[model samples]
Target chain A: MIPLDETDKNILNAIQFDFPLDVKPFEKLGEQLEIKEEELLRRIQRLNAAGAIRRIGPIINTKKLGGVSTLAAVSVPEANIDKVAEYINQYPEVSHNYLRPDKYNIWFTVSADDENRLNEILEDIEKETDCPLINLPTVRLFKIGVMFNIR
Target chain B: MKDIYIQLLRITQDGIPFTSRPFKDAAAELNISEEEVVDLIRKMQSEGIIRRFGASIGHRVLGITANAMCTWNVPDERVEEVGKIMAGFSEVTHCYERPRYPDWPYNLFTMVHSYTEEDCIRTAEDISKATGIEDYKLLFSEKEFKKTGIRI
Candidate 1:
């Protein structure tokens, strides 16, 4: 694990909670963290390089923005996991692909600009992988996305 | 105005540059004022188009190692109620009511993240106890091949 100082944690907390909207937003964040703006930016860059901070930006509600997404899962044999995953990853729309321990082992989510595009992608994935995949669409949104704070 | 916002979304969808003025860069790209860009962000946020403008930290880096996609066979009648209860837990990041297939006997899905697998299982059991939905399956992720937010 990358060692995170208190300032790093605070920066993560600040960015996640509410990134200030200002001409010099990092300056404002630095003031909040009692650090210099340069230091703040440097530390954030370091965190980014370390893969600690995934991205510092908006979580667009694509579904609300005329886009479609669905959860799809396939059961790949142990040896062919990487090959199948790589094949699925070739599609730019496929995101959050994880290998889970189940009959349906490789669980992935895909989002596209529209429903037709989404279906097309899923069909291609199923056809290419040669696996019986299930497309689990969201019936209801209990919690759309979680804003997880670093505790 | 709507067209311009679409361009803005395309520009900002990947992520704002970590530079001093993120909105300023997008504003420059869109040939609009920085104030206008920020205003559009606020407007989109208030309108619920922009879910939340924030950073997503690597959970594993912060000692949050375990991750479980816990699916429950919650009754159709109790999906909403049980979903709310499941979402109430701090560890449950995502909660949704999804349709179940003939083979797949789970409807309610919750993504649980914790420090360990044991913690995740315990939390799932706790959820089962609280919701009184005894049937559940915890699909712990063995490997994360790809995990990035939506890109337009």
Candidate 2:
């Protein structure tokens, strides 16, 4: 974990709740934190480099943006799993994938413009890979939200 | 060098409150107009910067049971087909393909949820049968270390 200073923790906490929407958002944040914008930038960079944060960007809800999204898993032979994962990750539609302890291990999220297209991509993958596939569409969204407690 | 992106990322992940005039209330605290807040959120959404602005409920509070992450070892040639079949399940919330590590045996992954663990297991069994893959395993989350939005 990154060793964060008081200012860094404050910055992280403030941003998690209310991200300003302005031409100079960071400047706004700096004002609230009573720090220089440059300092804020430097701190974030340092934290990111230390793996305290994965990414600093927009978290779009593809479904709200008129796209179909679903979580998918594939089971590839141990020897060829890496090769297969590389192929699947090549598509822009895929967001995150992980290896878990299960018979069917490669897990990833797919988002496309439409359900039909999403299905098409899945089929294409199936035909190309010649592997049995399982498609788990979201039946219901029970809880889909994130909370970052900086306090 | 202040990176404004970090600030933006963190704020969005925390989520906006669900209120009659959430933007107005939030803006008041920030000393900004409600319109300004609305415009900013709109732009963020249009740019694919913020995924969504809504309430994120706790699944445990909702009495949801039987959540398990399942994986499979699919043939190189038929990975896509098997993935699509697995994704077709309504009970599935998440599914994906990731690089397989040497120590890790399973490759494909999917998540299933039902009223009970037994139900989830049953669903997994059905999926295995439906997809025609014999070798598969289910791993349930033992503990949640930190399940929250990542705002860096």
Candidate 3:
């Protein structure tokens, strides 16, 4: 892990929330931090190259975009984890998938334009993996955003 | 959805290009003014279509190695109240009230991130203390199969 300094922390805190939607966002960001635009961009590039800044962009609301998502978990045997994970990752709709240390080891979040498509993708995944999957759609989304205040 | 907004989403979904004049570059591609791009984004924000517009930081790179998906077996009656409290914590990234199954009884799910497993446990304990819901299980991710932002 790269040790982050005060400036990097400040930059992460700033960009993790709202990035300026202006033409020269970096310039505005730098102005806020009392840094030069060129310096700010350079730091951001370094951060990106170092894998700190994954992407600087808009976080689209899937539901607002007429999409539906569900959290699905499947209990994969120890031997078939790799093969099953590969099969599950083949679907573009499976955005976040993880092998959790639980009975239902493989957990994933799948999103699609609608319920039908989402189910179709999940169905295909179940068929391919030959595993019974539990679909736990959000009953109520209390919070969906994550902004780690890296101070 | 307007054609222009669709085009804007398509262009911005991958991420806004890191450049001096990102909006201008996008505007030039879509044949729209920079102000138009900004205006559309602002509108989308107001409409709750854009949850956030910013840099998606890689937490693991920042030494936040531990991620625990904590599920609470809260009572159905108090699920909402507890969920609201859990959602207020900075460490609680994602919180939701999901339906319970016949075999699985966890109803409230939360994703907690920290630099260590102890930190994650502390966060979960804090949530438990705050909500007074102690029946919970934290499932740590052994391996990340895939992690990507959906381009919806």
Give the best candidate by DockQ.
Answer: 3
- Supply candidate 1's per-residue lDDT for A29: 88
Q: Write the per-residue lDDT of candidate 2 for residues A23-136, one digit (tens) a residue.
A: 456667789999888787677566555544444335555454466876666776778766767777777777666655456566666778788988887888777776556666
Weakest 10 consecutive residues of candidate 3 chain A by summed lDDT: A16-25
Q: Each candidate's chain A: what TM-score? A: 0.79, 0.71, 0.86
Error of 3 at B99 (Å): 0.5
Q: Scoring model 3 with DockQ, what do you get? A: 0.77
Q: Order of candidates by DockQ, top first?
A: 3, 1, 2
Candidate 2 C-alpha lDDT tens digits along B15-100: 44322243454566556676766676666666655664432323342245457877677675667777788877766766666545
- Computed on alpha carbons, the lDDT of every model, listed in order, comes to 0.84, 0.61, 0.87
Q: Is candidate 2 or candidate 3 better by TM-score?
A: 3
- Cα deviation in Å at residue B96, candidate 1? 0.8
Model 1, A46-122: lDDT tens digits are: 98888888777777788777878899998788898999999998888988899997989999999888889999988
Give the candidate order by descending TM-score. Answer: 3, 1, 2
Number of clashes recorded per candidate: 0, 71, 0
**Share of native interface contacts present in candidate 2:** 0.10
